[model samples]
Target: MSLFNMPLLIQDTAAIEGDMGMLWMLISGILVFFMQAGFFLVESGMTDSKNAVNIAMKNFLDIAVGSLAFWFVGYSLMYGADMGGGFFHWGGFIFSQGAADLFFQTVFAATAATIVSGAIAGRTKYTTYAIFSIVMTAIIYPVAGGWEWNGGWLNNTDGIMPAEFIDFAGSSIVHSVGGWAALVAAWMVGPRIGKYLNGKPIEMHGHNQMYATLGVFILWLGWFGFNGGSQLAWGGDDATAASQVVLVTNLAASAGAIAALLFTWIKNGKPNLGMTLNGALAGLVSITAGCGNMSEGGAVLAGLVGGILVVLSIGFIEKTLKIDDAVGAISVHGVAGAWGTLVIGLWGVDGDAGIGIFNGGGAAQLGAQAIGVLSYAAWAIVTSFIFLFILKKICGLRVTEAEEIAGLDISEHGTIAYPGKRQREME
Candidate 1:
């Protein structure tokens, strides 16, 4: 009998559903992959022009290295058969039936790993960065992902938590994990040379505001796929729900940008462009966890809070913590991601599923969200510190003073992003 004409195949609803779902997932994955360009532009534009080439190189290599690492072991560790009571998994090595799913997940792993690059830019050794990307995608990100998305203890229906933890698209699992790791990495790498003077941070401005603004817009575009694709299905009601998710995502991003612009204008007496850009990102990260569950109003509220928190957190990290994050990745992703995840416990709702505390669900959901947030932070911080410390001892994490001042493009890559008129004049 022909496969297409088989009665069982024709009658199977799941088979038809899988076909559309896979196609949507692949499309979404491609959109997420394009986010790498966004990251490159944002990182390069936010840092010194001297390091622009190096920044671009790192971002490119992050996807390259992260994809291979995830394919080799990361996917298996995340989605393999449950072992040791869901602490980890084994098997499913190489490729399996879900190639499309694997491709989709690989991009997400890369996104988490790449978030750290901006924090340690301008001063990191290229070789060391490569190693970090591999380890992060293969081990750090996958293990955390297993815990939430792969039937691990955190999201287990019968787990220790009062209520199942909710991270619809990994605000805590992906963003916070990356953010916490970036925090540790920035600390270990130390601040860039001349970043501090007399125990106070010296102001450093990005060389190109236009590039940074363009990057923000690109990221905003990519986020529709990032949040919408998490629905994991594209048939019937799922299609409508995905559309709603995209709508809320857009609203949150706009609200976040406006809030940050106003807040910074009030505080600094002028609207800071960089802060405003980050504010949009903060809003996006804040809504990622609850976009599918929350109403548009809830998303705006979350984004508004995220924008204010990011500005405040960036100031604290710079002034009080003395952590020099070149692009504020830690504050925008980690802090806002945590805030977004926690808000789900307060505002999350899906039709009749009242799972938020303020919606009369009580403290169970809130407690679960808190536990998930803390666990991810602890795991990311501890593991990142250990890995960074070892790498520092083995190969050294930062460039020398001469190398840094000379610019990573010239010192590390032996090329300049912009040779300027000197080359033309010489010719």
Candidate 2:
């Protein structure tokens, strides 16, 4: 059965394609896994100095805990054989057949779970946070993912929706699911001590803006794989499609950063670094859903809109809603993600149908995208609320008032991120 002895015709053409796909998936998965580092840096840098180690620990634990949870249960719930009319998968628990595929998906699951950590940082009990991570990876994220990615009703070609919901690379499945959960979790957990003073919000600037900037850069680099690899194939046209996705993804991120910079400069009379960083992320999230199907121009527009939206959304969430998201995770991921998904209806280009309302495809795709957004939002928010409520009742979600003042690095992890610096007194 040596290859040289085998007949040329007997060798499978599809097998070669499969091998290429696996290699691409593996590389992309590795890239996505590195995003955890980006998250750690971003969250830690955007918050107080004392909580840096604590934030880093949670981000690290997300990958470790999430991988195991997804392997044992989440993968099955998402991609296993469909059962109960596609509401869930019946089997495939603890499975290992497609190693590359499993690895690729595990990173995505971890990402969804980690998004919540940033929102609830500093105040959460470590034990409760660990449990939340497991539940998100093993249940919440997987179930929401199953709806579209695993051939559930949302993306079902012949479902009740006007057209299939198109989330090219998980704008809704990964980002929005994470975002909505973050929002719910942040709201339920309440604000950090001194985040609001006398019914007015107070600004708690991050300890290290340099770390946040570097983290944003790393996340931008990782997004190439995040969107490009969603093509799921690497041969012929698939290769071309993937390359285009990477290009547009970059364009959108750039446009978003510029837009946010300009907007903030106009509003604040100075260019704010934090808003600029968030703008770049907003653009990336905005274009993720439609990257494969959008023109470069459309991507630019999406990014521009996303960048502006993020700034406004952050203000609204902070001022009007009074929700304290230490890193603006909910606005950047949830709000921008929803916009990106919905934009697909206006900008998407695929097949003979042309796939977007402005592209002569009518309102079918738009309607579907809307449905997908609302559905995922409801699911994520409700499930997150229930889980957080239960945890709040059973274990109490927050540390004591004394713990809040002492910093989680000392109270939770028994060490300080900056060893010698005097602990700043809580205002």
Cα RMSD, each candidate: 6.8, 7.0
What digit string (tens of lDDT, one per residue) describes model 1 on residues 1-427?
Answer: 2211111100011321568888988888898999999999999999999999899888888889899989989999998889888778866667443777788889899999989999988899999998999999999999999897877889665768888787878898889999999999999999999899998999889888899999999899989889887877787777787787788889889989989999999998999999999999999999998887777777888899999999999989999999999999999899999999999888677554556777666888889999999999999999999998999999999999999998999999999888983377569
Error of 2 at 356 (Å): 1.5
Pairs of residues at least 3 apart in sequence or in different chains that clash in candidate 2: none
| lDDT agreement with native, every candidate | 0.86, 0.86
**Candidate 1 colliding pairs:** none
Candidate 1 ranges beyond 4 A from true positions: 1-16, 95-97, 421-427
| Estimated TM-score for each candidate | 0.94, 0.94
